[model samples]
Target: MNIRVNGEKIELSSTVKVIEDLLVFFELQERLVIVEQNREIVTKEEYQSTKLGDGDEIELVHFVGGG
Candidate 1:
């Protein structure tokens, strides 16, 4: 399916179906980030079951350490 990720248009891989899968697909499983899908904030608990479809908008915000 085609999804817009952080303003970039890209096609989701065939093996990706859920938010969790997408994270792993991008090697972000262990990263500290917040995922927003279609303008809705997706909680960590929802990642496993959140279904991704065509035309979806996904934004990933990574957390950075600061002094």
Candidate 2:
């Protein structure tokens, strides 16, 4: 399947079916990160239930400390 990640087009395996699973696949399951799918913010509780489709766009933002 093809999905746009952070404005970059990429291809992934078909096994990546849901939003939550994708996070795990990318090794970004930590709660400190925020995920936006198709322009909507996805809650941590809903990540597991959020489904992803081909041509969908996903954005992941992580917190950093530098002050």
Candidate 3:
């Protein structure tokens, strides 16, 4: 399926059906990341239930520690 992530279009395998799977695919499953799908902010608890589809727009914002 094709989707737009952070303004970039990319194709994903069929195995990636939900937000959780997407995170794991990107290797960001363990990080503190905020996911916004199609202009709506998705809560962490909803990750597993949230489904992704073709042409969907996703914005991923992950935090970094420094100082």
The number of the candidate with the highest TM-score is 3
- What TM-score does prediction 2 earn? 0.86
Lowest lDDT sum, 10 consecutive residues, model 1, at 24-33
For candidate 1, the per-residue lDDT at 12 reads 83
lDDT of 1 at 29: 87
Query: Which residue pairs show backbone clashes in model 2?
Result: none
- For residue 43, model 2's alpha carbon misses the true position, in angstroms, by 0.6
Compared with the true structure, what per-residue lDDT tens digits does model 1 show for residues 1-67? 9999899999987889999998998788899879999999999999999999999999998877889
Q: Find the candidate with the highest lDDT and give its number.
A: 3
TM-score of every candidate relative to the true structure: 0.90, 0.86, 0.96
TM-score of 3: 0.96
- Best-to-worst ranking by TM-score: 3, 1, 2
lDDT of 3 by residue, 1-67 (tens): 9999999999999999999999999999999999999999999999999999999999999998999
